[model samples]
Target: MLCYEELREAVDNGYIIGDTLNVVRKNGKVFDYALPGEPVRPWEIVTVESLIDIMTELSNYQ
Candidate 1:
């Protein structure tokens, strides 16, 4: 699982939204992007490391 810090950065950068109730797969893999202001699931796992990679890719936007 990725760290929270990296996930937060991704959320802040608009790379991912952490508001889904239960977007992950049954085995705790794969995540669905949530809309803004949506309620987040209590057991949702934030992937900071994954977010870092996503954000890094998005940073190339001009």
Candidate 2:
């Protein structure tokens, strides 16, 4: 799935909160958008699916 799509889904489902996103593109680029002073952090995932994805990424680096 696309990174933005996954982020959107997580937000819509209330799986993430209090943080913003910095999506890494397929071309190995990091894209982060934030307000001047809001300084939002990474989103919080309150779902199992998000946790699974995170674990998958971690294992890949191992």
Candidate 3:
């Protein structure tokens, strides 16, 4: 998960809250985009199955 302050800063700096951002590896040799865009944080799981599961679970919570 992205740090609270990091998320805030990102948004304040023009990054959309739900925008799927890329996670660049520490070595700067690798990077992956977990989501598309709009309010999710970094390091958040973003696989198609995971997304479906999350949506289902969230819907249940609601």
Q: Which candidate leads in lDDT?
A: 1
Runs in model 3 deviating more than 4 A are 17-44, 47-62
What residue pairs are clashing in model 2? none
Clash totals for all models, in order?
A: 2, 0, 9
Q: Which stretches of candidate 2 lie over 4 Å from their true place?
A: 20-62
Best candidate, TM-score: 1
Candidate 1 stretches with Cα past 4 Å from truth are 21-62
Model 1: ten consecutive residues of lowest lDDT? 17-26
Question: Candidates sorted by TM-score, descending order?
Answer: 1, 3, 2
Tens-digit lDDT string for candidate 3 (7-41): 34554776534433444332332222233454445
Better of 2 and 3 by TM-score: 3
**Candidate 2: minimum summed lDDT over ten consecutive residues — where?**
27-36
List per-candidate RMSD values in Å.
9.5, 11.5, 10.4
lDDT of 3 at 30: 20
Instruction: Give lDDT per model, in order.
Output: 0.46, 0.40, 0.38
Which rank order by lDDT, best down to worst?
1, 2, 3
